[model samples]
Target: MGSTGERAWLSAGLALLSEQGAPSVTLERLCERMGMSKGAFYHHFGSMPRFRTRLLAHFEAEHTTAIIDAVEAPGGLPARERLTRLMAEAIKNTGPELEIAVRAWAKQDPEAAAVQTRVDATRVDYLRKLCEEAGHATPDMMAKLLYLVLIGGSHVMPPLSPADKHRVYDLLLPLLG
Candidate 1:
């Protein structure tokens, strides 16, 4: 009925998407999970397509924009420090299952694919800027290298643990010089 209600539905949709992939994010499933009715869903989102659009927007905001905002909040940190903070925030805030699920969803849905492309480009662009600020010889390549590692790591079976991801970043960060 309000923004809070909409957020609850969006959050539940994300959880469902993460656990069971996009196929399971149906109106019936969501309504059943939330103990609400289809009327409630329609009341908030108007239609399933609209809800899916909002859900993807929520994912981008939470998984990308929010992390970038947090990393940039305490300004004046050195480039390397900022990069480290960005990696840390990413590891802490993002769930590998959700990332993989959305990516898989993107493969089949044009809208999801567009969002995924934007998210990947935004992330890589941010990483490239950080690399440039750190004076890396090939900032673009270095950014791709780092981002690829993250994307690759997420798809690995069992996914990389936060500690392990941190170790990987630690090894890579020294190359920024």
Candidate 2:
């Protein structure tokens, strides 16, 4: 199968995972959502395990790496500006339900847990670098704190609204200077 076919399956999987959690990301559900057959899925992913692995990779690449890349794309932005862009991009690009579902899936799936661990570490490390560049007195601690706020906001009942998230960031960004 072509990359488009593979991406279709991954996209369908992500939608299902976001709407109904990992338990809904079965072959039948994906096939139904994509209007494809088991053969198509197998042709692209070979097996359910492989599909799950690929889905996790897609999630990490889209939700983590892409956000960081976008934030870093413009040369010479101040660290505070980059940090703000990072948070804005994250809130805009990633769905709260999807993030919650992935975290829930990681609780039971070792592969997912490993990916989540790596994503978390990468995000915190990037945040630390930005905080350090911004001259925060305690960059590591600030990074963890900012990351924790974002994670906590996602997991909270009803989740934080995008506007509210920005308000929170507005309140916090001044501390970075």
Candidate 3:
């Protein structure tokens, strides 16, 4: 087993985690669903903890790191506009089910909880700094509020339609300035 095996497990784990949450990400489930042998998972990850750690890192990189790069990419847009673009991209990238699963996992796993904390911090801090760059007088409080809205929106309701999402952005834009 090599990168192929590693990718297989990670892909299976992410699928299960997103569809059914942490409990569904068991090694046996991954092996069965991905049509891989148990030895393959072990060869790639060695243990459950290592697999989980890598999973979190992979999720972070896929979800957050790329967006960070995109938002910071050189453009004529102002910082506030860039932040708005980032928010739109983030909303597109994440599924509410996957987020809910991760949040639920955070309740039981310290590593998952820590990863959640870092994700929140990174996102909130990015908003804070962007607000600062855009000359918000109360960037700290605004960042906290905005981040809360972003996270809490899905937990509080069903998925927004595309129109609703645009409405939300419209509502949020004036506040950013």
Candidate 4:
């Protein structure tokens, strides 16, 4: 299949997952959304399981890249600043809908759980590296604590108000520093 068709399928599949959840990503729904027949869908993915595997891979790859990019952004920002920016961007990319989908799917799907575990590992590893770069004492503990705080906090709370969010960065910056 052409790249355009592949992208369309991914977009449609994500939409299905976000809008109606995982089970909603049926071949018929994808066909309906893409205006393609089951043949096209089958040609692209042998089965729904394959399609789901691809989608999860896409999510993990995209998010992992985003994290690395944020860290590499040219500005000489401190580690804490870089981490805050990365967290904000991640939350922006994974809004409530997709988060809900991931959470819902992870409960019943070991594959999804493993994908999430990889995501968590990537995040924690990144944090650990940043702490080490900053010469922070107890880098491992700081990284684990910060990762849990940022990720678990985001999972539970909506994005904070502008003032409160800035305050969060201010409070966290000194600790990382």
Candidate 5:
């Protein structure tokens, strides 16, 4: 936590936030979790509002930017595997509770909502890129369906059994080819 830079505080803040809400993401709590002083947090972020700003940015950067870049990186998995990894990472990375917490926070804060909107757009665009790269017959439609399925499947319903996810993905492969 001492050496991980600003993200250490943000990560701790997120865990608190996911467990409770934005109100729980205080410097004292984050610093306590990290075994650091409030001065450490202030060293990276001047104040609470600034730390909150960095939290949302960090969430997007880790969850969206990092994952998407890895999937599209050079000499990795094939298109299908990449797409599978995309879905896996999309739903698995931060856990649903964190996502729900962020959305809840967004209701009271414009910055959080702005970040959410940007992240959603980035994800949908990433889905479109995957479809295009895979040469899907109906790339746009597939992107939309995949996006909606992920959103509905992950939040509205319980986690899909691995076998059931495989079954759905199998049916989706033909649409790609």
Candidate 6:
């Protein structure tokens, strides 16, 4: 576990990134925001690049784990149904704000971009596995398409109300059929 000061600094950094985008988040800026000395920031993270890497790694781990948990819950539901429900739930939980923040950060940091790629790959892999379990012939293609549609839809479509979300679930009925 990191020290309280270390955690506080990282939290401030994430807030800065989430609220104002990556370019506005520097060690100097974070230190000033937290009213901490440069020494405190340096104590936890060796440099700005290192801090960015750690932040991205943290986001990737949390997001992937949440996806895996949601899709693999203990149930006898059909694979396609589980996949759609899990993805919709993920989108609802992580609304557009956080997604937009990450996209903004990725545009500014190579490390963030790399982590985003890995996260997207992981999503595709999970979808492919689900399609395979459902006996789809072209699991890879199905997964890639499903992944794109889900992520793209989350951004483009309005956040579904509960009733509308179930209707959105119906749109996936064809895949299960």
Error of 2 at 136 (Å): 0.4
The per-candidate count of clashes, in order, stands at: 0, 0, 0, 0, 0, 0
lDDT, candidate 4, 1-177, per-residue tens? 237777689878888888999889888999999999999988888888998898887777666666577667877887766777765665556555775687688888999999988887887888788788777888888888766555555456574444454466557657865
- Tell me which residue pairs clash in candidate 1: none
Ranking by TM-score: 2, 1, 3, 5, 4, 6
Clashing residue pairs in candidate 4 (N, C-alpha, C atoms within 3 angstroms): none
Off by over 4 Å in 6: 1-11, 32-36, 73-81, 157-166
Candidate 3, residues 37-58, lDDT tens digits: the string is: 8897888888988999999887
Candidate 2 C-alpha lDDT tens digits along 1-177: 239889888988999999999999999999999998899888898999999999999999989998999999998999989999999998888778999999999999999999999999999999999999999999999999888878888988989988888889889888886
Q: Alpha carbon lDDT of residue 124, candidate 5?
A: 86
Q: Write the per-residue lDDT of candidate 5 for residues 1-177, one digit (tens) a residue.
A: 224777677788889988988888987788879998878778888899988888899888887898898777755667777888887767567566777788889889999999999998898887887788888987788888887665555566675644555567667767787
Q: What is the lDDT of residue 138 in candidate 4?
A: 83
Candidate with top lDDT is: 1
* Candidate 6 C-alpha RMSD relative to the actual structure: 3.4
lDDT of 5: 0.79
- CA deviation > 4 Å runs, candidate 5: 1-3, 76-78, 157-167
Question: Judged by TM-score relative to the true structure, which candidate is superior, 2 or 4?
Answer: 2
lDDT of each: 0.94, 0.92, 0.81, 0.75, 0.79, 0.72
Q: In model 4, which regions exceed 4 Å deviation?
A: 73-81, 157-167
4 or 5, greater by lDDT: 5
